[model samples]
Target: MYKATYFAAALSLALFQSPAVATADEITILAGDLPPMFNADGSGREAEIISTVMERCGHTVSFEIQPFTRHWKTYASGTGDAVATVPVGMPLGGHQSDVYIQYQNGVSFLTDAGNTYGDLAALAGHSVIAFMGASDILPGLKDAASSFKSYKEVADQIGQSRMIFGKRVDAVVGDGMIFAEYNRQLREQSGDLMFDPNQGVTFQAIFEPSSYGMNFRDAQLAEDFNRCFAEADAEGAIEAINSAWAERYRETLGTQYLGH
Candidate 1:
């Protein structure tokens, strides 16, 4: 009878301590504040994708949004459990997950400028402006800058649109979506930026797509993310999130957004 009682207690303890009853972990993710992709309030498409995938993996998620370059520094200093939007093969230490997002970087010039960039080489001898640290972040950009008439990088991406609209530069180089978002803001709130937002702009896909992923401090978390992300993607949830954001841009920026 005592043996039976011992077995019952052991079974109860095992049941109580089972993985099925384990509480979900909350993971804090650090990301860049690139709107329409990643926002400070954790409401952007990338944020939604991360939240959805992590939730599917039975984990709660939070975000700490910083500047595009600063987030890498924040991650390096061990500030968060994970960092998103990290380019593949970046030197940051951690278990990197599969490439889950892509940023389409390109060169934008006035559609009326009669400008056509078949490739990065075509950008030669043109005054160009790009996001801060772009030369370092973008492959071959440093070498390409040497041939441009003039090249500069700005921390505030809104300046990319303003500089191009104000005729301060021949072109702006960055993500098409980010540039579109800035243009949308300029159209709504020109303020002191004296430039014609109505002017047609052309985005030339001269560079390769920027593939990004997440890095997790825990290898198990990275594996779990990969599994859950694949599962969510198979269910079409990931594509739905992407399409919803693209539709928002389409409504705001017209059919020109995303080559649509």
Candidate 2:
């Protein structure tokens, strides 16, 4: 009788101590403030990608958009659950998912801007505008921008574009797809800005196409995230998201590099 009583108590204690299955919680993604990619104001494609892909995987995502420099601080501290667009081989964090957005970034100019550059050497002589931290990913780009202006956010891209309209600079070097989006927005939304992005501008690709992906703390989460990408691709989510931006990517880097 005493043994039976002890067994019942042990079973009750075991029942009480056992934990419940964890419900997948939301994760915060820290990202650099790159327009059409990591904007906080609902204009970023990567933000949409994170939310969409994570949702498909039964997880939620919140984005913390800040300067490119600030992104590393948040990411390295293990505070942010994930980081968007970590270039391969950066010693910031753990497992990185497969490439989400891949594009060719390079120097480009308006056909009528009268800037002539056939190669990297010729490009070294011209003033150029580029997104922040471009030199880190694209070697020789910063050095080639004789006069360089780099902005840290989406809104700043407008200033970079306006420089072209105002003739402040002869060329801009950055992501081809991002440049196309900026050109589209600056021209359509040019209210008080009054800048025409399509004055026969012809952009040429200078750097090889590059790949980037989300990096996470744990290997399990990263593996799940990669699987989610595969599932998302199968379900047409990735293609849908890229449809708006694929033109520039396809034109510059080809489809193979669209969403690696």
Candidate 3:
């Protein structure tokens, strides 16, 4: 009887000490339709990274691509379980994960323009265009741009690319990859021969890289994501994805660009 009792206690302890398996969950992750980063076809750097991290944590993910600004509204309306590319310290009641990606934002101008913006203040009298919500997210942008000859924020980065390449704007501000992709698109389309798409441009690294994270409505999922993200990051999975995309963009644009 004593032997039997000891065996039962040992078995109970063993069972209690065993690792728990996470129940698989279907996670809907809302993202913006940023090409080469978050695509509508559910293929991009962020898509792959989110999939890798969620699957590692025993969850399946589906991306709902929306406009850059529209995704925030959709997330606020309780449409999805998580949102990606959330800026740091945004006022939202959700569990935020570690920084997953960073966008290199700065001023871009024609290489032969012989002009330089060593600082945001230097752009005092130049016409500039930027992505939507740039003033709200990027500190000092609105203040500096207030002094510009003209400054406009548009939802379509493709337009930004066109304006800058056409010499219609003195400068454009946004992600390097986004601008490069749009420029490549302009080159492919007909009837845009007025401005050279292949014209060399230089990006003035004036702004610090903008870091972003994933926000999850479910606390438990956010916890799992953080843990799994750390694991994947340590394994260099994120870097590999970033590197592959960077190479593809370099080939596509025929120039080196900021890789995510």
Give per-residue CA lDDT, model 2, range 83-144, as digits (tens).
77776555554567887766566665676766765556766545666664555446675455
lDDT of each: 0.76, 0.63, 0.74
TM-score of 3: 0.81
The RMSD of every model to the true structure, in order and in angstroms, is 13.0, 13.6, 13.5
lDDT (10s digit) by residue, model 3, range 166-205: 8999988777667766777777898737778888877665
Q: Is candidate 2 or candidate 3 better by lDDT?
A: 3
The regions of model 2 sitting more than 4 angstroms off are 1-24, 114-118, 122-125, 142-156, 184-198, 234-236, 247-260
75-145 per-residue lDDT for model 1 (tens digits): 66657788888767665667789988877777788878888876778889999998876786666788889
What is the TM-score of candidate 1?
0.81
Q: What is the lDDT of residue 54 in candidate 3?
A: 88
- Which one wins by TM-score: 1 or 3? 1
The residue-level lDDT of candidate 1 at 155 comes to 81
| C-alpha TM-scores of all predictions | 0.81, 0.71, 0.81
Ranked candidates (TM-score, high to low): 1, 3, 2
Better of 2 and 3 by TM-score: 3
